[model samples]
Target: MMKLDICQSEVGTGLPSYSWDWWTENEANQFPQELEPSTWVKLSEVPSSFSFEEALLLCQCSPDSWLAWIPDHGEAVLHRSQFS
Candidate 1:
């Protein structure tokens, strides 16, 4: 699997407020099969400061390739497969 280092955007009141910087086609494809395209939107309510372990499970990311900053939460390393 390919690993992607993404910078997460700040949270907003509505959808599309968060974006993953540096994610490529291959990296996006690495997401898990159980993930839906709309899942991210659904989970957008998750606090930005959430933990890496929490983001891993929340995003269903593989534990090795994921990394992001959740505003007040801090930062974490997550897996590409988690967002499938």
Candidate 2:
């Protein structure tokens, strides 16, 4: 299994963007997702304490920086040095 590398630039900040390609092109049903939009881990690995994106971070299933995240429709993506 290929581990997704969380993108961290020299500035240590990322512009998390929604990639329908990233979201769709990521997996081929290797793992069951709790949330089809962002989750890539198995359903049992999902943590109730964290958001789905956070779970992706903790699981290291993303290739984008912390700023790069899955966004709900109409939700705005802002520039932030810190997430949450």
Cα lDDT computed for each candidate against the true fold: 0.43, 0.32
What are the per-residue Cα lDDT tens digits for candidate 1 across 9-51? 6666454334555556886667555543223311234454332
Q: What residue runs in model 2 are displaced by over 4 Å at the alpha carbon? A: 1-17, 25-28, 32-54, 57-84
Q: Model 1 scores what on Cα lDDT?
A: 0.43
For residue 76, model 1's alpha carbon misses the true position, in angstroms, by 0.3
What would the per-residue lDDT of candidate 2 be over residues 1-84, giving only the tens digit for each residue?
899989756563554543233433345444343323343222222123232342232222233322224323122222222232
Worst 10 residues of 2 by lDDT: 73-82
